[model samples]
Target: MSNRFKNLIVPVLAVVLGMLVGTIIMLVTGYDAGAAFSALFEGAFGDIYYTGETIRQVTPYILAGLAVGFAFKTGLFNIGVEGQLIVGWLASVWVGVAFDLPKIIHLPLAVLAAAAAGALWAFIPGFLKARFRVHEVIVTIMLNYVALHLSNYLIRTVLSEKSDRTPNIHDTASLKSPFLEGLTDYSRLHWGIVIALICVFIMWFILQKTTLGYELKAVGFNQHASEYAGMNVRKNIILSMVISGAFAGLAGAMEGLGTFGYAPVRGGFTGVGFDGIAVALLGGSAPIGIVLAALLFGSLKVGALNMPLEAGVPNELVDIIIALIVFFVGASYMIRIFIERLSKKKGVK
Candidate 1:
């Protein structure tokens, strides 16, 4: 079989095994797994509103997956995606609310503010890693906490008028679309989905069709060799992180301008950043794969909400299934070996 076909087998098996395990668990716990799954499917796709909402949920996941996957592809573990996303959301909302410009200018400015803020936030760790030999993971983890508290402080002091959230962004800066809303029963779907799709294509093109991409991937494969081959290793490292952060920032912009229309003081992580790790892994860091993985995750998340209402099953059961799927993906090596064994058996016949 072709390598691409073989590559597809791992995730397919992982998802199947995850669902099978989830069913077994439900049965063992005395719940009707069939009804639960049926509800899930219905919730995800039965109605136009639900379908639109699922797509809305998917929008951020796509950008977040790109953020994490791009970094991983370039040999960086950007654990700071949450921190970067938080700052991006804050920056985007700040610009959106602070400005009074034409829609053509204001919207792009807010979105660019988000991307710039995320890139700036990520640059710190990237610089440290490149210059001081610090681990990006450790720095990024610490930055996540710093971002959480700092954003809250800024909200209470700088961005808010004694309120916990910023004011709603001007309509000119908003991504919310009345036509899309009407089409989907007033779902929060917006133009960010188009931007996310564009970004996916950009990433694919950058990595597959550009000299810069070749250098970046080369550095990722072997930093010393890439340096020896006359590539600016440190520069590529920082650039990769910055680009990854830009995508993460756009994810935040989706929430601020498209979903909520304002930036609220978050008491904790948004969870989207962390979930990106799973999405990236399952997608094998490929752009198209990331989109597909995001859709699956988005479906599960939106669908899980109906579990209790329709089937009397705890929604957290879906979380378990998601975790199992990630676990199986993490065990892709084993799955590949199993496939190879089966191939060998067939050959022997």
Candidate 2:
């Protein structure tokens, strides 16, 4: 089999195995597996509203997955994507609430603030790694807590007597599109999906076509070799982290501007960032792969809501299915070997 064709087979088999396992589990538990799956599909794509919701759900996942995948490409484990996202969310909403400008200016400014805040948030860990050889994973994990508390404190101090959330951003700053919403029958879908798709192509262009990306990838593959070749491994590491955080920050902006038009302080981390880790891993860390993986996870998430509502299946079963999918994806080497063996048997060169 050709390399491109082989690349497609493993993830597809992984998905199939995941669904098969989910079916077996449902059968054992006395739930109607067919009904559950039917409801899931219906919820994800039944109508304009459902389709819009699925797209809205997918938008943030794509950006967050890109964030994790980008860092992984540079051999950095960015555990703090969650923290960066929190800060970005707050920063975007803060800018949106503070600004009173034309729509074009206000919206772009808010988005830029979000990306900057996220990049800055990730910079701390990057700095530590570059200056002291400290592991990024630890620093990022600790910073996640710091970000959570810091945001909470700021919200209370700045928006005191206003509850956990900031005021809705001005129309100029909001990402909501009445025209698009009307087209989707008033779903929360917004312009963020377009931005996400653009970022996907940008990611592909950078990683596949840019010298900077080549240097970053080389450093990740072998820092000592890259250093001997006169590459600035330290600088590349830091730059990779910054870019990763920026992607995550954009995901937060999607939630703030498009989904909520404001941010509510949270005591705990949002799972989006962590889910992104799975997305990145399952996608083999490729730009296009990550987007496709995000779509799969997004559909499951959006569809799971209806399984319980209409099929008499527990929502937790959806979690089980997701866990199974992740498991199969992580163990997909078996599928690759199986395919290779079958190809050899067929003698197809």
Q: Which candidate has the top score in TM-score?
A: 1
lDDT of 2 by residue, 1-349 (tens): 8888877777787788889999999999899999999999998998999899999999998989999999998899998988888888989999999879999899999998999999999999998998899999999999999988998888877954557878888899888999989999999999999999998898888888999989999999999999999999889989999999999899899998889988887868888888998888778788889989989888899999899888999878878888888898888888778888998989965
Candidate 1 lDDT, tens digit per residue, 1-349?
A: 5679778989989999999999999999999999999999888887999999999999999999999999999999998888888999999999999989999999999999999999999999999999998999999999999988999999889988779899999999999999999999998899999999999999999999999999989999999999999999999999999999999999999999999999898779999999999999989899999999999999999999999999999999999999999999999999998999899899999
- Model 2 steric clash pairs: none
Each model's backbone clash number: 0, 0
Look at candidate 1 and tell me the lDDT of residue 39.
97
Minimal lDDT window, size 10, model 2:
156-165
* Top-lDDT candidate index: 1
Task: Predict model 1's lDDT versus the native.
Answer: 0.94
Local accuracy by lDDT, each model: 0.94, 0.90
Candidate 2 deviation (Cα RMSD): 1.6
Error of 2 at 24 (Å): 0.5
